[model samples]
Target: MKQKAWAIHFIYAGIFLLLAGGQMYAVESFQLTPSATKFLAHNVGPGPDTPRGALNHLMVNSGADVRETIRPPGWIAWAALSAGAVMAAHGGLLIARKK
Candidate 1:
């Protein structure tokens, strides 16, 4: 019973991850909200030399609309999708084995 429950949880989690991964994969880039931008600026600090720091500074300090853009690498999506598929498959196998 416990094993079956775990299997179900895994299946659900895998499906959610797969969906999120697909969404991330589909969207090439996304804009950061003002709050998110400010948060990043605080964390990233005010250094102007590095590209990330420059962007962060601009978004935080500039009065003009300076939305930060996030471009997730291709590997992350592929990895998430692969992991979700593997997890779902493993869960299915576990459930089958228990029966």
Candidate 2:
């Protein structure tokens, strides 16, 4: 009975970690485009040079042209991969113990 309880606990923990890590990874990887810039420009009053501008000045060309991009650090991918691996290992151990 105790072993079964432990197995269930490990399984649940593994699933939760895997899902949370995946969500973090997805959020970090998502990127915005020029269309988003146009939408922001239309909805928002400020231009790219403004303090509240959505696009960075370095990437923006003049006040009318704005380009936005997102690039996640390699560490984020590594962390996600590590979390997934840990989850797989935990599940594998749980299954092995049952045998």
lDDT winner: 1
Q: Against the hidden reference, what TM-scores do the models get?
A: 0.76, 0.41
For model 1, the superposed segments whose C-alpha errors exceed 4 Å read 44-64
Put down candidate 2 lDDT per residue, 8-86, tens digits, no spaces.
6766776666776677666755555777855555565466567666344434434555655556776775676677667
After TM-score superposition, the amount by which residue 62's alpha carbon in candidate 2 deviates from its true location, in angstroms, is 35
Query: Model-by-model lDDT, in order?
Result: 0.84, 0.64
> Which lDDT tens digits does candidate 1 get at residues 40-83?
77776666788978866765787666567899998888888988
lDDT for 21 (candidate 2)? 66
Worst 10 residues of 2 by lDDT: 54-63
